[model samples]
Target: MKELIVLTFAVPLLMAFLLPTISRVSFTLSKLIAPLVLLALAIMVVCIWNFHTETFVLHIGNFIGPQGIVFYVDRLALLFAFAIFAMTLLMWPWYFEKDESSDTRTRKLSLTLLLVAASAGMSLSGDIFNLYVFYELLAVASYGLIAAGNKKPAGNSYAAAFRYLMISALGSVFALLGIALIYFQTGTLNLAHLSEMKELLNNPAGLIAFVFILLGFGVKAELFPVNSWVPEAYMASSKRVAGLLAGLVSKLAVLVIIKALVLIYPQDEARQLLLFLGIAGVIVGEFSAMKAQDMTRMLSWSSIAQLGLVFIAFSIPGKAGMLAGLAVALHHLISKPAMFLIAERWGGSLQNLKGRAQSSPIMAALLILFALSMVGIPPLPGFWVKFLLLSGLSAQQAWLAIAVVLIMTVVETNYLYRVISSLYSRDEQQSVTSRHRTADTFSALILAGVLIFVSVQVQTVGQALDEIAQDAVDVKSYIDLSLGGGS
Candidate 1:
């Protein structure tokens, strides 16, 4: 099991480098290998989730101290590892235009593999150094993927990528500064060690370090004040790339923040800071989405709002916070990606979508289901997710947050209803000429199926998420498993 945990990241990292060479030999064979490797890793994660429900630690190279690399594997980590592989596999750029070069295809494939490797590593790493390394790798892969999304040489994707690159680089600097401060104070970078020395980080300097780290990571998590890149990047990139960024990568980034919060900086000031930013993010995202003219940008802004909701849930503290955050994160994971897939064919000015349902009824129905789920209609997973969040906020007496969330839901429903109305309008002069690709629709259906299945089993899923939350917040268990009694 330990070896498998290592293999989750290691194998993909190795395969990413080897893929170009493999393509030199047989292009077809190279294509087969990436998905095969991802499938194997996904299966491994599922098995671990079933059989090794207990939390464990892997010390790479049998190195047992703060000097060595460590991977802490709990059910929460395993679930995210599985999501990285599964989502990457689903969003893999399998289709290319007839004029598209073989080199472009290979480059995209290699970068996707690198992204999977980095995302998995970020989820499992037990030390700050490796997390930073993985985070940088994730950023590089994302930049390349976004820049390569559009086929035209002078496409707007480059401008979007450049903007994203600048913001991400700045964030990286802040994160590094935070890590240096941490190391300067503790002489150690291991998370378990940091948790044991929380008092040392409870001071003002330590608080500053936490803030720097949060803002750094917040760039990718779509946290406010650093998320200006979201709409531009999503609009410029392909639907698949946008979906991957929104549904998978952002959640992993949030995982990094939550891990830090639970392990190193369990303080009210930290939580409150997160809450304030989350509220601003929700306000900005929902209103901007409501005003968006295009489907792609609207979904992008909606993603930002959903992540804001995620941050809000996590800010509540303890198991309730964890449970609510997980529910919102996972639910958004399913619905947002599927919406992006639908937008593959339906993209453009909302005015252009008038009467699209007359042409693509199945996709229209799917869109309605997703929008309803996102708006928190009863019996849907999104409803229960919001219920958990509201319950948690109510318990904490966060009346302002409760009010903001409710108001935002109304704002969200208004925008979504407009899109639906456009799709189903009775305009006889509708200009939509293309239907959703069969392959894209099939991929979206799988995610939709998961959403529906979870809806029916909401109770079981909620209980399971609650259990994972309990395990996640058990700080002593994490420290003991990682450091072996801090010996």
Candidate 2:
């Protein structure tokens, strides 16, 4: 089982290398391989779930020595890995169908696989250095995918990708410097060992290291201050790539931030800093999103806000907050991708959705479902996450935090309602009643099915998230499970 954890990261990476060669044989064959890869991953995730008793770790080649890297699989990693697999499955077909250019299509597919591999690597990585490596891998692959379309848009893609790369490089430098400082202080890069030696990091050097790493990971996670690159990048990338970026890549980055907080930082001041930044993110992201008109742009801004909420929940310093963060994280992971897909099909503006529900009711319904989920409507998993967050905030006497959340919620509701209202309105002025209802219906139905499934099974899903959050908070359990020699 431990060895299988390594395979989860390795397989997609291996496939990404081989995909171009396989594409030369037949494009259809290459496309066929993607879902199979996702299926295999999904199967492994299920197997992990069925057999899960505690956290586990695998060093490549079973190399438990100081020289080799380790891949740790806890419920937290598994949960995110499962999300990557499921969203990839949902995304692949649409991406391929829309992308008819063979070269671009092939590159897109390869990048997608690479993105998955990197995300898996980040999730499973037990060391700060390994996390940085995976983060770079994800970033480079995203650059390629964003630029894999028509030359006009590709130029925008290049500019966005370049800016992203530059900012990311700066972040990486900071992270590397931090990692170096930590190693100097503790003589090891293993997160578990670092946690054990937390007392050694009580100095200014360690605090500086923490700040650098937090900024590095926070930028990628779309946290405030450093998140200026996100909307433009999403707006510039092809819709499918946008979906991947929004739904998978950014979430993985945020997950890494959470992991670092849980495993590497045990200081109360650090936790307080995280809380302060998170509250600021919620306010900034929501207010910014409220001003956006383009659907894709709106979603991008909304993602920033949603990430802020996730960070806020995680920063609350308790089991309840961690659990709430996990729930919200998972909910957004599912719904945001679906919303991006809908945006792709329905043009990029809310105005264009006028009479969309009348034309393609199914697509409109799915859009509404995802939008409502984002707004935390009843019986949806998103609602429960908010419920948990509000409950946790009230308990902490954080009235300011509560007020910020309320303001963001109202802003979110207004914008999401605009989309919904446009969809059902009788005004046909902005709509083009097309004969391509089949395509629209098919796309919408798939997303709708997923939204409904997640909604109905919220408790079962929430329990899984709770387990993951518990594993996340249990640092001792993580160390014991990862390095316990399988006895």
Candidate 3:
């Protein structure tokens, strides 16, 4: 199990480097290897489904403590690894099948594989510096992949990529500076060590450090105020890039924030900050999405809104917060990517989707199901998580936040309803060229199946997420596990 844990991420990171060499012998082999490796990873993840609820840390070599880099896996980390690897596999057809631009197809494959590795690494990191390293790696690959494996990019694509790069670069600077400040105080880069230094970190300087780090991650997390880049980037990038960004990358970045909230600073101010920002993000994001002219742009805003919910969910300051956060995060991962892919193949703009449902009724139905789920319709996968959030807030007497959520639910429905109307709208100028492919539709159906799976096993998943959430709030346990039982 431990060896598989090590290989889960390391294989992809190392294989990405080997892909260029592999292409020399057979690009065909190299391309196939990506999915095969991912499939193996997916299998490994399922095999280890019953990973010990207690946190497990794997130190590299003889290194230990502040001097050593350690990779840690908890249930949350496993869940993250599982979601990312599986979704990338489900969406494999969309990414690899159509792009025949490279004879070897090594560059995009390498970038995609590395992106997966980086996401996994970040999730499993126990060292602050190591987390930052993985983050930078994720950022770089994301920028490259935004080009969609093309040397000659499409309109505004380079600009979108550049915007993402610029924002992330700035975020990196803030993160490094915060890291420097922490190192100056604690003289250690390990999360466990730093987590135990909450006394020192509770002061104004510590609060500043938290702000810097959060803002740095905020760029990638698509948090409000720092989320201006979402529409442009998702709109300009390919369907795969948009889906990846909206689905997995942003979630991992938010995971960093959640871990920070748990292990470093779950104080009143921090929780309030999270809640305020979260509510603000939801309101702002939904309004923006409501105003969007293009489906990609609208979905981009929705991702921001959904991430805001994740933030609010985890901000509940205890076990409930963590559980709600997990449910929301998982639901978004399963649902949003399919929508982005559908939009890519079916319609870019709402108007373009007129009579689209008539053309591919199955896909249209899938789209409607996903949209309804996202809007928090009853008995759907999305509603349960939001219900968890509302329950948590009600217990806390956070009436304002509750109001915001309820109001936004209606607003979400209205915009999604608009898209549905567009789909059903009559098109006099319909062209036969606009058609849906089975391969593309099949991947989305797999995602839909996952949603049903989530719905069916909600009770089981809910309990598991609740346990993980409890684990998050149990900061003492994380500290002990990370620092080898406090020496």
Q: Each candidate's lDDT (Cα)?
A: 0.91, 0.77, 0.83
Best by TM-score: 1
Report the lDDT of model 3 for residue 298. Answer: 89
Deviating ranges (above 4 Å) for candidate 1: 151-153, 485-487
- Clash number by candidate, in order: 0, 0, 0
Better of 2 and 3 by lDDT: 3
Scanning candidate 1 in windows of ten residues, the lowest lDDT window is 478-487
lDDT per residue as tens, model 1, 1-487: 5457788888998998998899999889999999999999999889888888678888887889778888999989999999888888888888876877777788889999999999999999999988999999999999999998764547689999999999999999999999999888888999998999988989999999999999999999999999999999988888898999999999989998999999999999999999999999999999999999999999999999999999999999999999999999999988999999999987679999999898889888999999999999988898999999999999999999999999999999999999999888788775747977787888888998998999998888878888999999999988888888332
Candidate 2, residues 1-487, lDDT tens digits: the string is: 6467666678988888988889989988998887797788888887887797666677766667444677777777887788778777766634444536786677788888888889888988888788989988887887777666335633777888788778777887877888889899999888877777888887788888888888888777887778888888888776667777777787888887777778777777777777788888888877777788788888888988888888888877768878888777777777777777677756566676677777666667777777777788888767887998999888888888889998889999998888888778888365556533344346456766766777798778777777767767988877775566642
Ranking under TM-score, best-scoring first? 1, 3, 2
Give lDDT for model 1.
Answer: 0.91
The C-alpha RMSD in Å for every predicted model, in order, reads 1.3, 2.4, 2.1
TM-score of candidate 2 against the unseen true structure: 0.93
* TM-score, cand. 3: 0.95
Estimate candidate 3's alpha-carbon lDDT, on a 0 to 1 scale: 0.83
Output the lDDT of residue 378, model 1: 89
lDDT of 3 by residue, 1-487 (tens): 6546878788998889899889888888887888999999888887776655456778777477768887777778888888889878766633454646554357878888988999989888888888999999999998887755333444477877888889889999999998888888878888888888877888888888888888898888988778888888887766777888889999999998888888888688888888899999999999998999888888899999999998888778788788788888888988889888788765455777788888788888988899989988767878897888899989889999999999998999999999889888888998554666676688889989888887888788777777777776777877777778322
Q: What TM-score would every model get versus the actual structure?
A: 0.98, 0.93, 0.95
